[model samples]
Target chain A: MYRVKVYVTLKPSLLDAQGKVVKGAAVNLGYDEVENVRIGKFIELSINENTKDVNTAVEELCSKLLANTVIENYKYEIEKE
Target chain B: MYRVKVYVTLKPSLLDAQGKVVKGAAVNLGYDEVENVRIGKFIELSINENTKDVNTAVEELCSKLLANTVIENYKYEIEKE
Candidate 1:
């Protein structure tokens, strides 16, 4: 099997409200050193060994279902299992 | 500055309803090669270079705010930036 790990993150130009909130909370909790924060999604998919073209399949999956292309960017790494 | 990347994932023993839903959708969308699907969170934090004991601070942050110890596990990597 192939284990595919995908990370979907907001576009660099966009403001990350959730990250801002978390950073604010962290400072309030006394973590003054903490600075800029960004939040994203991590997805793991297990693909069968016999599957052909794992790269193409995963790319399609990410563009179609795993990420919102307009506002986010996604990247994936595949590892043998 | 130190760039910290944190990944928070549900415990292996827990039922991930969101993952199940996504897996089902993938199957429905004809990505039959796809198997197990799991979802998690990815957080990036920047810490001042002057911060002392980054490891300890990050550990405390993970346990206290970034992750729910009862049902989730978190791991992080730090890099100089």
Candidate 2:
């Protein structure tokens, strides 16, 4: 089996409202040193042995559905298990 | 400065409905070898220099807001920058 780890994060240019709230909460909680708090999605996909050309396949999958290219960026790593 | 990477995932006992949907979609797209897909959250907390006891601070943050211990498990690492 194989495990694919995908991390989807917002583009730097976009304003992260969720992150801003977290930062505010952090400061309220007395962690005044906290700065940027970026929230994103992490996805794990397990693939069995039958798949072929896994890299290209995953690339297509991510680009087609898992991530939005216009506002978010995604990076992935595959591990054999 | 420090960068903290946190990964929050559902407990093994919980049903990952979104993941299941993705797996079904993958199969429909001809990637029949795909098995399990687990969806989770990735958070980045950037901290500046004034904070003390960062490890404990992050743990507290994770427990209080970043993750729901009842159904989610979180692991984190800090990198000095």
Candidate 3:
């Protein structure tokens, strides 16, 4: 099997409202050193080893279902299992 | 400055409904090689270098705000930027 770890994050150009809220809360909680924050999604997938072209399959999954390419960018790492 | 990357994931014992749904969708889309899927959150925080202890502050943030320790587990990496 192959283990794929994907990270989907919003483009730097876009505003991350959720991260902003978290940063505000962090500051309120007295973490005055916080400067900026960004939030993203992390997905892990287990795939059968027999699948042809594991890399391509994972790329398709990320672009088609895992990430909203218009606003978010995704990258993944594959490891043998 | 310091860049902290945090990943919050549901405990392995918990059911991941969202990931299950996505796996089903992937199958429907013809990527049957998928065996299992799990989803989590990835957060990035930029902190000032002057912070007394970046590690402790991030640990507190994860346990107190970023993660539901009862159901989720979190880990982080810190890099000087």
Give TM-score values for chain A, per-prediction: 0.97, 0.95, 0.98
Pairs clashing in candidate 3? none
TM-score of each: 0.98, 0.95, 0.99
lDDT tens per residue, model 3, A1-81: 999999999999999999999999999999989999999999999999999899999999999999999999999999997
Q: What is the interface RMSD of candidate 2, in Å?
A: 1.2
True contacts kept of each: 0.84, 0.89, 0.85
User: Once superposed on the true structure, which residue ranges of model 1 sit more than 4 Å away at CA?
Assistant: none
Specify the highest-lDDT model's number: 3
Candidate with maximal DockQ: 3
For residues A14-47, write the lDDT of model 1, one tens digit per residue: 9999999999999999999998899999999999
| Model 3: residue B51 alpha-carbon error in angstroms | 0.5
Interface DockQ of candidate 2: 0.82
- Cα lDDT tens digits, model 2, B1-81, are 899999999998999999999889888988787788899999999988567788999999999988999999999999998
lDDT of 2 at B80: 91
Docking class of 3: high
Worst 10 residues of 1 chain B by lDDT: B49-58
